[model samples]
Target: MKHQPINGQHHVSMLTKDAKQNLWFYTEVLGLRLVKKTVNQDDPSMYHLFYGNRNGAPGTEVSFFEMPNAGQTRKGTNSISSFSLLVPNDEALSYWASRLDSFEVPHEAIVSIGERKSLTFYDRDELTVHLVSAEKDNGIELVEPWITEDIPPKYVIVGLGPVELTVREASRTKAVLEDILGYTQVRTVPSMGDSKVMVDIYETGKGGLYTELQVKEVNDKDRERPGKGSIHHVAIRVKDVEELTEWAAKITAAGFENTGVIDRYYFHSLYFRDPNHILFEIATDGPGFEIDETFDALGENLTLPSFLEERREEIESKLHPIR
Candidate 1:
């Protein structure tokens, strides 16, 4: 197998109009633990909420940046399109379908995507989400689910699955994935009924649902007008800071301008945009969320990196309370 530096998706971040509502949908409705309650380091005026398993492990997180006045996202090409979460088995998919209905959350009937059955739905901000069964795949390791009284641990989302990237030209992004990032193009499949678009599957380390990146080639649509509910970027996991440095050099050698390595405090990160203008991040796995908060007290308090600690009072003054 060809060596790939990226393990799988670390986390997929999207835009949300309301942080409190976003918190409720993922924690109360979906049963993911609010692992980190912090502000976006780039823009400290707003919030960045992270949800994942009990530990907020790399592959399981789904995050959001609060954009208070942002409008609805306009769907089109050149976008991250949708993000999926893994369910333990087909039975879990069934449980989620009923759970979503009980909350009056509209969703599509479960349908087969490749060898796995997936149910599609939208969050409160209309961000596309899929609950895919991992029964047919044997590669990914399950993380400890955030235990909840109402939802069974078996049915809770285990980790993030294949992230769909819908772009005008797949070849451009394909070159970046395969040539620069060392990903292998695994297969191609028809999207759904009658659509001319073909979804190309690409895999990295350990090659399974969690490590796959699906690229949908669609030429008919316009470029996306990103706002609320639109994915900002998807972070790919690397083992540590040393490997991340190697990747920074590799990306630079490829002639693509990138944010060299950044100290995120929790995990170091390197950011770059693909040819389609879709932002991609390569992030380290260690020095995790527990660096600041204890495992049990993870997301309970407002946590800030050392540099931002000085401005905590001012930052808190600008933001609305979200709990």
Candidate 2:
């Protein structure tokens, strides 16, 4: 049986040093809504914050891990080179340029990427961010929530953009993206060095939910050490639970180890590292943020999965309140 194409982004998870600062950066500065308030299951000592468009749609999400004193990430080889978001048009991009300026946020002047225009900036943790005038995303349609109603609807960020993944070799990565993940090569552009970089645009068309796998000719021996400002994993969207299983089979058959299916409460997930050891995830798009709270009350209080319900008090106490 044939399955759905891996759509655009499900979510991009990154590490941060302070939850409060990260919260302010995404929610207040970027005007995204904090839809989920929870702790990192792997390490309950840390906070896992989910920020995205109005209702926290799959492709729109950008989640963060908050660990104090974890240090900052160093940019080198085998890392997620860039992450971007989609706005409606150049006007929105201009508004962002001025909005960021008002906050004294240092950012790059608007730049063009392929056919789209974009403004680049850095979060408090120094993680790079881009706001692009998106093309058209024909992927799974989403009801983009404008939770921050005061912000102009046209200027609000709709979803994610193509994220660049850096790898030492392109052959294995190419095979995995095409055969295993089922992505088509959209275009290749001349980059800084030799061997043009491959650009794979998803149905995330207009929104730029694409992936740019950079083929590095020289193997830099220095490895990436994860801390603040580093991407934890880049997740691509799947239709549902069953499709996730199919992905697991295909991935394993291709000789990559995966985390199988994991219940993240809101959505199901399967994780595997790329040839470059950059973490990648395939996540379902359903049973989203509303499953736990009313649409109006999202991010208002602490939320725990059923297993962690008993320890809610302890968990709440440990986390410094951001809301």
Candidate 3:
């Protein structure tokens, strides 16, 4: 059976130690708006903060879970090692370099990836993130600070561009991405080989920038541990709930156990893993970040899923105070 093409990248969330620091980095530094602030349904004391363009649109949203007292993660083989963010243009690259310096945030010089220019930096929690400025061909609108007098209200994120993982062997994981998830092997970019094997995977998009996976070969795979500084899971987008269900079954049928459908309030999700031991999630685009709140008031309150609605007070109490 022919399935519908996967939608654009939806969102990516990370687990952090300090919610306030992450808020400042994503909102104040990177200029993403705080679209939602809610408590984790499973553990309410920890806050789930969502940041993105002004309205917290589906593809633009990037969320974080503030878990206090969590140990740092050793980003080695067996983890989603690093994530990249897309900027508008090269002009934005210069703007971001200056901004990071002015804010006293240490960052590396602009580096070239394929035809794009990127600035590599780590957040307060030590998660590696990159800002890439490339020609926008996906038709998704972006808020260019260098062009606007005021920060724009909404900028279409165009989903995840690429994620690099450290792994012991790339062949097994490569099979999962190709045979199971249906990603095509585009080409190898040797320019990114700084002691790692960087492979690109093309997913739902016009110019093949939606999803790319790079795996680095390492001697020890068991050294990596999941914790605060590592990615919990990298999510790929599907059209809607039905698409998500179909994809979940596909995953299960392929002999991988999926977490099943999970109502994330903003989107439904199912979790699984590739052969290399990196966690992956297939997420829906329906009932987006704009569901409970207006475009203008997206991050104004601590929103929760209906399952955790009755524990609002308890969840609020558990969260570390973020001023």
Query: How good is model 2 by TM-score?
Result: 0.90
Q: Spell out the clash pairs found in candidate 3.
A: 9-159, 35-298, 35-299, 36-299, 45-318, 45-319
For this target, which candidate reaches the highest lDDT against the unseen true structure?
1
Quantify all predictions' global Cα lDDT against the true fold: 0.90, 0.75, 0.70
Which one wins on TM-score?
A: 1
Pairs that collide in candidate 2 are: 54-145, 135-206, 136-206, 137-206, 161-208, 162-208, 162-210
Per-candidate RMSD vs. true structure? 1.7, 3.0, 3.0
Ranking by lDDT: 1, 2, 3
lDDT of 2 by residue, 1-323 (tens): 56667776788999999899889888888888898988888778789999887788887889998889888677766777668887876788888899899988988888665665778888888887777676443432434656474578878887776676666665666667777776666656533221244444323223334433333422564676777888888898888999899988888887888899999899999999877787888999888999889999998888888888898888877778775
Error of 1 at 216 (Å): 0.6
- TM-score for each model: 0.97, 0.90, 0.89
lDDT of 1 at 214: 90
* Residue 198 lDDT in candidate 2: 41
Using TM-score, rank the candidates from best to worst.
Answer: 1, 2, 3
Better of 2 and 3 by TM-score: 2
